[model samples]
Each structure stands twice: as C-alpha cells, then as structure tokens.
Target: MARKPGALRNGAPFRDWVLPAAMEKVRKRLKTVDDGDRQMVTILGCVPGDGITAVEAACQEALD
Candidate 1:
C-alpha cells in the first residue's frame, strides 16, 4: 500500500505515549461490550519499521 502524505514513520506530531494510550482505550471499550459483540470487535495496533504507529478497530462492521 502507498503511504499517506505527510505521515511520519515513527508517529510524529503525536507524543510517543499516544499509541499505547489509544490501544488501551480500545481494549477498555471492548471490555464493556457483550460477549457476542466482543467476538466481533477487535483492536489492531500497527508499529511500522519506519516508526509509524496506528491503532484501529478491525471488525467494526461485525460489531455494528
């Protein structure tokens, strides 16, 4: 996949702590979900070699 414009490899602009905090937030949110919903919901964390980090829902559609 092509890289997004103006993106840093090491997760710039945001503080270094932001990625972990975001993952934790997603985990916390999923914890409160029902068992069926929880099965569908997933938190994905990506740490690129360039130092870029990302966290996002992997199964939003399933949860919905």
Candidate 2:
C-alpha cells in the first residue's frame, strides 16, 4: 500500500528525528560541571504558542 506524506508505517518521525536533534543541541549548550557542580537536569515542555514560550522562559530561569 502507498503511504501518505509525513505518515510513518509505525511510530513517529518527529520523535525520532526532530526531538533528538533539538535535544542534542540543548545538551551541547549546557555548561560543564566540576566536582562541586551539581548534575541536575530538568526538561520542560508545552504545546506550541505562548505556552511554549512561557515554559521555555521558566526552564531558562531554573537552569540559570
């Protein structure tokens, strides 16, 4: 059978490609740690639009 555009036979392409790429970039931007540095990591996500911006700002503040 023929498949539709952006339609995967199984699972989600965005989850495999887009999310991983974005996360890799985020990880690369993270600061290095020393023995005294904490190793805590937090992730915040929200739906597109103003909600996402708000969540991102909150994450930045928390991370900072």
Candidate 3:
C-alpha cells in the first residue's frame, strides 16, 4: 500500500481490509487531491506502528 498507494483502491490484498469510519472518510477526501494516494499511503503506513485506533483518531482530528 505504501509503495503502490493506487492498489489501496482495487488491490486484492486490501480487498478485505475495512478502515475505520473516520479513516475511510479521510481517504475518500484525500482522493480528490493531486498526491492523495501517496499521502494516504503514508498515513496507512503508520498503522503498523501507531495502530489503527491511533491512526483513526488522528484522521478524525485532521477532519475536524
């Protein structure tokens, strides 16, 4: 996902990975930006270390 952010949209590996509501919302919003894919991938990459809950909270904070 970090290397090929575009795959996050239709990649088989991420087919079953459901994002948190806020994260998903942020992701959809990011899709509109020119480098959104890369930006989202960077955010997603933080999940392994920061955890989904933390990332989700951050996404929510960002949205707010």
Assess every candidate by TM-score: 0.32, 0.29, 0.85
- Top candidate, metric lDDT: 3
Estimate, for each residue in 1-64, the C-alpha lDDT of model 3 and write its tens digit.
Answer: 6677889878898778888999999988998998898998999889999999999999999999
- Runs with alpha carbons beyond 4 Å of true place in candidate 2: 1-14, 17-50
lDDT against the true structure, each candidate: 0.36, 0.37, 0.89
Better of 1 and 3 by TM-score: 3
Predicted candidate 2: what Cα RMSD to the true structure?
Answer: 11.8
lDDT (10s digit) by residue, model 2, range 1-64: 1223223213375345443344344434543433111121333224244464565555456546
Task: Give candidate 1's whole-model lDDT.
Answer: 0.36
TM-score of 3: 0.85
Clashes of 3: 0
Clash numbers, per candidate: 3, 0, 0
